[model samples]
Target: MPTISRQGTDFIYQQVTRFISGQISSGVLQPGDRLPSLRRLSDRLSISVPTVRQAYVELERQGRVESRPQSGFYVRARARNALMKPAPCRDCKPAPVRCRSLIDRVYEGIHRPGVLPFGIANPSMAKPAAKGLNRAMKRVMARAEERSIGYAPSDGEPSLRRQIAYRYLELGGAVEPEEVIITNGGQEALSLALMAVAREGDVIAVETPTYHGALELIESLGMLALEIETCPEEGLMLSSLRSAIDRHDIKVCLFASALNNPLGSATPDEHRQELVALLEAHDIPLIEDDVYGDLRFDGTRPSPARFYSEKGLVLTVGSFSKTVAPGYRVGWLLPGRYEERVRTLKRALSCSCGLLQQMTLTEYLASGEYDRHIRALRPVLEQNAERMTGLIGRHFPGETKVSRPKGGSVLWLELPRKVDGGHLFGQALDENISICPGMLYSPSRRYRNFIRLSFGHPWSDRIEAGLETLGQLVSGH
Candidate 1:
């Protein structure tokens, strides 16, 4: 790793990215592997997070690595020359499955402009100018011009990782820069972390009714998912996890502790403590996804399970894609004991991005504007969620159940028996509304009557009208 300047926050990202990129191109690293998580890289390189983020952005732009949807950045499929080429796109699938799967249809059609999209998971910008992202991009352009165009680091910016660590520390975690590894996105971080901890055919445990992305990653890796029954309110069930651990040769526990997928539930502090204890006892590590942890509409900043577990098995994955800036493709990880493995995985995964982008992010993050923006956003999201829930209760005919989350922006809806949410997905599309049918959520067709509705977007009369139409579709009216 290159020596980083600790004076300015952004400089650290630059040094780290440079070192990593050089390592990648010079054949010092190989592909089909992982990278050090953001925290680890930062601490080791002694840089800030924005700097790390800048390097990661450059590497991503240069196509050295690719980010899997819910997985972390990995070395390009073929390392060496591949880093000089473009990585695969998010929708890049080896083989397409145009299924009669109802949930698939709904998810596919959700993004159509006219449709009320319940299948989408991200927050929408009412006007592109809401977050001043344009300003940040302009600054990046300026930096790139000032510096000679060269390869960034495989590990990303030390400074950006430091910033990530700082943010984590602020969020109530004991993290150092070395424990961080800047990633292309939260998903990439997650996928890479899981890959580091578990391998193919391993019996990895996942919370029941978990996010589809996690399940898909596990399946993609050819691992057997040991389902851990989680409570509707408390999130992951620790007792059940212990039972599963005793019965199986479990490798890793993939969980969404705060703002869990589809359910919008936050695991309690007490439960988290117990979970850490149990996992430590069993010697099983946790891959914790906290991507939505920052968007706590309920104002309760949910603490992660990593805080309680000192054994370094709690690998926390998070990203800025959800709240602050999505287009930038900035994400990070705090992998406890799996630090070296994560770093190696990241280096193999195409290295990291440019010095310019990482530098810009360093400015963006350290600018002190993030908090103000988040504060402005939180209320809007909370209100919209409430509005959608109210509409669902008042309009939908069946005994539809909803999960009231302490955090996150998505709502989980459980339709009445035999309602066939999959079928409703197609019907909703016809009404110009998209929905996340529960069939897409699990490996099995268990929650066929369930659907996930995203309320993070700007609420307008069109949204209200769309919800009304959806109600009609679900009720067969």
Candidate 2:
């Protein structure tokens, strides 16, 4: 029985919120446990009913609790088996990426008809903006008419570029429309940024278990990738980075510090600031892979790493593929000092992104539908993450550890040491389930016992069945 105090400076609802949170933290109220009725809690705490309701509403907003129709609030199943220790990256060194063949096989499984897609990381598909986007596209076509089909400028459509810049402004960062170069998607944005900054054989420092696409890009460009130790919680470890910098002839640092793939670790703003400062001090450029920056479960987007750059060495990449529509293939780059080089590369490479997609997205943003879609999408992703995590806990081996994502749509799992992730991927594929093996994520072939599963799709019985099968396989049952 927790009591509220009026003498405290905090608001009454806030105090109530803290009290309930403390109970949840201590397991005094377990997952699936019903919370006290609002009136009952009000009477117990000697507070007004409205204050209690406010506290519950706040909790609901935080994804800590849920209210049933005509019923009171109940605790959500948030039993997080968070990866407690950073994976070891002993003798970290630059090496050519060697996982392309396996990556090809994994992707093949992803497109196989009737396969349960736990391999892909496309979050927007979980609750797609199909209707909204279609509506926007129709509006764009109707408004722009023949112009929508015409070639957009090599740089990008001016209206779409302004929208991208305006979003950065909303995030407390200043980005010029001219600084925005629309690429085919985030991958192209990343490729252009990398090309603008570094060339063949340049050592690129990356988080240990990094995105496979980045590694593939490095491999394609004939660059070496040095592994940097990254925390499962906070993202890139500065100490490991500093040491790597001291030892290697590292030319560039390409990191998904905003929200790392697989691990789903979001670096705090202060950490990102330090990262930018440290890299800029060493005169090494950072290509910030921020494709998932807008998909945080809490709906609070983290500031792009470029915000803290003093030397203009931070090049940030953003995309609508993960947020709105993957096939739209709309993404932008803030190339900092390398804007001219990136623009030239963009023109030389793809000429320009799809004109219709750009016009459609610009209309989506201007009509306020983009923001509303994002707000609605975040909760679906957060709920899906919760349900998947809970099911994994219920079904997987007791020793299995999973990443508790702050946002995004994937869960990184560390299975038993003896379990081969590659073998598991093969087995899962045979069962019509596609999974991303940990080997594909690293240049040095770390995470041999790990695999990443996506909860990005709409939840269904098939997904539940797939997890159970995966659990059985992991258990050798």
Candidate 3:
């Protein structure tokens, strides 16, 4: 037992927390190991039982341990098998996207009725803001009447644009309402940003295990995607990016530097600054996908990479699809120096988004209900993440590696090499359980033995059973 310092500035509970954390770090206490009882630990450490209990409670809040009804606190088996190694990007050359068939199959599985959806990455569905949004829409209809149903401007509603600008301002980023252009969703924002910067046959740099939708968009535009090595924990590796930039005639780099889609890795702000400086120095544009920026478990909203840009080469994409209402299809883009070009593309493509959805979102943001819903929603997602990770650790193969997300609502699993993710997806679908095969996430089909599972839905016994069945399938194969 470590002796607690009485005269030190640190509180006794904090000291206890550190000691317990150190034990866990050093493998003195393994996952699922029962912690010492509060009374027992207090007696051993010569401290009050309340102090020890406080430490245990703090640990529980951190997702390090859980307390049972009739049992004491125990370490959570959340991520004993964490993905530490970066996924390999061996032939990091520019190639035309060719994973469309697998992506089509994955989408088919995701939309199948009565199937457990583990394929989609829809986070807001975990704790839907339906009531608040409906109320906001009702208020919009009552106020605007017939105008609510009319088409919004090509650049979106003014009130929603100002609200977005205010949010960026709150995060210490100077974004003018005029600079914000609303779109159909983040997908359209990405498409507009891509079109604004690069043209057909242009080579776009993307993360190795990138989002499937980005690949689809690149294919449709007749562009080639060059894979850049991405760390499962830290996101796009700067060194690998520098190497790719040196070797390829990269026109534009599209990345989810804030919070990645499948891996849920968040790049440090300092790293993002270096990334921005690196690209700006070369005069190459960076389109940052920040749709999942506000869903971090810690509630710390990372400043947009555009905030670090000195040459105005960074374009930011954000949306309410992942956070608020996906079906509403309201998203925005801060198009840096290419604002006029993006506006033109938006006008040519979708013209304008739904006026009612824009007005409802504007009301949602203005009335303080959006922030309240976000605060309430984050904890539920975090809890769901913990539960899903723990269950995966319990049921998956011993060699399985999973990404422990910092936020968002999905788990990326690297199963045994013999297990084919595509085959597993088919098998899971036969059982009426939908899962996303890893091949869809990459243009090169590198993640053949991997899969991404969504924990975005409300937790239930059905989900638990589906996970268990999925585990059994993996074990049998």
RMSD of each: 21.3, 5.7, 5.8
1-477: candidate 3 lDDT, tens digit per residue: 898999999999999999999997776775556789999999999999999999999999998888855557877665568897788786778989987788889889889999999999999999999999999999889999989878899999999999999999999978999899999999999999999999999999998788999999999999999988888888889999998888889999999989988998988889999999999999999999999999997788999999999999999999999999999999999999998888898999998999999999999999999999888777778777767777787688999998878789998999999999999999999999999999888887889999999999888899889999999999999
lDDT of 1 by residue, 85-144 (tens): 111112211121122344345556965777666678776352122446557657667756
Residue 409 lDDT in candidate 1: 70
RMSD of 2: 5.7
lDDT of 2 by residue, 1-477 (tens): 666678878999998899999998776875546789999999988889999999999999888898866656877765456686788786987899887899899989999999999999989998988998899899888888889888999999999999999998998888889889999999999999999988999999999789999999999999999999888888889989988888999999999998999789988889899989898888999999999988886677899999899999999998999999889888888899998899889999999989999999999999999999888787778778767876787789988888888788999999989999999999999999999999888998888999999989988899889999999999982
Q: Give the candidates in order of TM-score, highest first.
A: 3, 2, 1
Cα lDDT listed for each candidate:
0.69, 0.89, 0.90
1 versus 3: better TM-score goes to: 3
Q: Estimate the TM-score of every prediction.
A: 0.75, 0.88, 0.88
Q: Which of candidates 2 and 3 is the stronger one according to TM-score?
A: 3
Candidate 3: residue pairs that collide: none
Q: What TM-score number comes out for model 3?
A: 0.88
After TM-score superposition, the amount by which residue 426's alpha carbon in candidate 2 deviates from its true location, in angstroms, is 1.1
Give the best candidate by lDDT.
3
